[model samples]
Target: MNPNKPSKYLTLVTEESRVEGKKNTERNPKNLRKHLSSIRLSRKLQSGIDTDFYEKITKKFLDDFYPKKCNNPSCEERILDKEISTRPDIIRCSKCHRQQSRLSYTPLMGLKLPLYMFGVVFHESFLQFPKVITATEISKRLGIEYKSALKLKRRFQLFCSDHLPKYKVLTYRALEEEYKGFKLNPDTETDVAPKMGLKPYVSADACVLYSASQRANKGRSRYRYGGLTSSIFLSPKLGGKQVGTLVHGICIQNGPAFFESVSDTKANTIGPLLVEQIPYSVPLFTDSGYPWLYNIYKNHRSVNHSAKSSEARYKLARNRFCKLSVHNQVIEGSFRLLKSSFSSYCYIKPEYSKLYLDEFSFIKTSKFFGLDCITERCFGSQFSWEGRSTGAREATVVRIGQEKYPHRRSSKETKKWLIQAIKDRKYQEPEREERLRRNKEQNKYDLNSAEAISRSRKALAGEMKRFNDFWSDSQKSKHKRKREIKYENLSFKIWNSIQYYKESSEENPTVQFIADKFKLDKRTLMIILRKWLKYGLIQKRKLFNKESHDKRVDFSIVLKSDSLPHLLYTQLPKNKKIFRRMDQ
Candidate 1:
């Protein structure tokens, strides 16, 4: 476009024309020497392979072949100048053209660094690396730039609170070995009887699950804080040798202005929480600390050595349940472990509580199967009975999305209905004012109940005396069999029922009498009776005696009056002929 110079398109052609046309000037010997010398110098420069030189050559080549142009539609200015070999980062145009700098979109357009670095930082922080430490610390450890590390840590903390799984299962194994025997501390007088296996009761108590807490103190005293403690239920199965899933966990405390505290001392707090969370009519076996609770929830049973008569306690001291002190001790052990392992939980940091639980849920599951396993194994037979009897009840909303639809009216109405339904359907009415009234009345009436108390005391006294009489015989025998065997085997009658045989035309003995006779518990005897009756081991007929309460029965078993009655019980296990193993 320059007027004074040859047309830009004809420059190459015009030069070649001159090179061909000119003889002496164009083909001069001096020119030939200069050209050959230039070629040699170029070869020498190439021989060294200097990286900087190569870069320059590449820049020159790119400039000559391809003129850089502004990508911005608003700017028509070329990045390369008129001199094909010369180019500048900041280019200008005489036509009043504007130039816009192009941005690199490969690493998130307009970003100073790659987006991957952001992800990297977020990921590292999510892994819970130390945050307060300088970026240099991370750089030294991960071998990255301090700047990158710093950015990553900052961004990760900002974004990763909700994405991670609250809990994860690291590992688990079936706990058969720990279930081999009950945990009975013979040295401790506090322990109840050890029966099934050692682990029992995963301890969980109600507390504020989440709430605001006093973040700062005033003057000289600590500020009152708002916070939550979850109602936690833990059950140790088979004395904690075997564990199960988290059976039930309820979060009861919620507030915007106040922090709520839940303690074991709060009466019925745990009971209601348990009922809300667990879908079973499970018996809550506890220690003496919860007499009030036990008094209320009839299903709640307590094992108190102090409450027992001296002889009875002594007799039961060696019994499995009493000897082991297995009653509800596992829950206490779990509490100790939880407090020890998670020291942060000591004061309950509100914000970090859930985050802590995220890690804890996984760790807990890994350590002791699911939370429910702890409850199931600790409660054992009762858990099964409750689970079955509870039947298919209403399902609980465990997570947010389990609800199909969520809205204000629906939520409020549902909540209203739920609260009313829970109150209405409770095993007993909440008692509200009635409980207070009854409590006051009972306090006064306790005096008049002296006769009843005396009667109960006297009956208990008689029972204790009888138990003591039997206990005294133990020291006299050089080789005394376990007194339990006699009591269970009916060596002495259970004291209430007397057996009578029919002298006239009659039927076989009822299963109940046969069970009573063998001293087998009703449950054990029932199975044998079914088997005997199936094989026609006894005849069936109806009869009545003075004590008979209508003894018509599906006759199953008849004890041989001549056979050693005790042997029938003691040898029953050994003699396969007595009862066959039915299909399980």
Candidate 2:
């Protein structure tokens, strides 16, 4: 019926088919092309997981872990030319006949997985820098157990951590100067010292990771069984208890970045760290919060984000474009990246924060160096497994051989020889015993002699005489009495008396007057005054005795203004007995 004149049903069906085809062709070309390419890419990648891929991985494993030279020191011939057997785990040196296992000393030692699976894991985890692949993902993708994938991933992380290069900007001389409280010695030869000019800028800042609040029971207690028992409900009050880890991060302009977990961001903690990590000559950019940065570094500049005045804001903006422009945005961006990386983990314990930071630093450093350089480093000899010595191997062989034999010795001839050696020792033993007996008798005869007794008595008398000369009873008692007195308390009292004299009278207090006032021993008072003068807490001035009309020198104690705060804040004992003897 539809052959000649198209039926309504047929026309409707044709129109519907045409519309569906048009809709399919009209789909977003960009998304359609991307979807098709991804499918092909995935298939190609999956196809690569074949025998050739395994062989390539095995070859690489052999190249990295195989011994390069004969272990024998005398015969260190290059073993690279030697052909690896089917079981490439162990290789033998052609010249020296020495054998070594490929995995002996490497992080891959004791690996139970196939080399291909391990290679896959390595390719996914290490090759993909800045892109994280969790163990669960690896397990799902590679069809391996989660525990195995995790172990492999952790091994790679540890390897990277151990072999990561520690970059230090400051030289040994600079570090020494910083350690010595930044005191410049005039005698130091500056002409020979290398000049570090126009050093690159380094920016430093800190960020908190895994910040979360703990929950507490906020509900009221309810009675159970007619008030016989009570139960407290936990309502989980969020934001009541907060916890986070403080991490200090630093990054050089167009260079690698570093991170460290710190307990605090105070000057005392971060100041020395900055000096150690960044050179003093280099310009440092930081926030206005760290006011002490100016005191620490000579070329330090801080940006005040909260500046209200237009002039101040304009100045900051101008500084950003000027010759010595300063900004810490590099470190700020690095912290943002770091926090993003940490976001992948559900929770990071405080103790392991350093390890995670090390990983982050390694990733940043690898980015700077590129993936090829990182691959070479990971395969370098530094990360190789250390093999056991030949002597140790021989000892193990001997132990196994002895275990195999019932009598320890292999044959009756060895047993007979051992028995003969033992008999020879037995024959010598008697003669040795006889010689010992004769020596003992001679010693007893010597002890019983009158000369021996007199010699012993003379030795004892000499020791007693020396002991008395070195440490007499009177000297011991004097030292003990002096040690019992609190020198700190005595010094404070003397300082107080000097202050009173300075404020109340025109003349300063003399040592003899203070000694008489405190009833302190003249010798002890001199010792305390010497310490005060040495520490610059007090100044000593020589005055002429006008009353005697003679050129006799008398010293007076004058407290220094610089040390007044130290004296004022110095803690003193609460007990009055400490100052009783000095007061008397």
Predicted structure with the largest lDDT when compared to the true one = 2
lDDT by residue (1-584, candidate 2, tens digit) is 32123232122224565565556557855555655564454444442354346545655754543335576777755564355657656666777767776554454556677666666655555566566667787777666688887766665555445435432321222233333332211111122112223233468887777653222233423222121011111122332222356678888644568887765555545666676776564556687656545334544556766544447545444343222244588798888777777777766655556656776777665544343332322322111111222211121110011111111121334424423322322211123344334423321110123342344345333433432333223344655434433554355456655765676677898877887787778877876665455445577877778886676566888887422211211222256232222221
Among all candidates shown, the one with the greatest TM-score: 2
Residue pairs with colliding backbones in model 2 are 105-385, 105-386, 106-385
| Alpha-carbon runs more than 4 Å astray in model 1 | 1-202, 205-264, 292-299, 303-325, 344-359, 366-584
**TM-score (all chains, Cα) for each model:** 0.27, 0.45
CA shift at 386, candidate 2, in angstroms? 38
Candidate 1 positional error at 3, Å: 68
Candidate-wise lDDT, in order:
0.32, 0.50
Which parts of model 2 are misplaced by more than 4 Å? Answer: 1-69, 77-83, 166-200, 214-243, 267-273, 289-296, 310-324, 370-584
Q: What value does the lDDT take at residue 32 in candidate 1?
A: 65
* Residues 1-584, model 1: lDDT tens digits: 42213232122224554455445346676666655554454443332223333334333422332234555555554463433123222233434444422212111122244333443333333334212223564556444577666544433322222212211101101112222322222122333334322222322332223222222211222232121211221112211111111122321111000011222233434455444332232234556545444223323345554444457436444343333333554444444444454443334333233333333333333222222222111222111112212321221111212112111121233324423322332223222354334323311210113343344435333433443344334253433435334433332222112122432225344656656555567666544343333434333343444456855434333443321111123222233464443322
TM accuracy, model 2? 0.45
Candidate 1 all-Cα RMSD: 25.8
Distance from true location, Cα of 213 in model 2, Å: 2.6
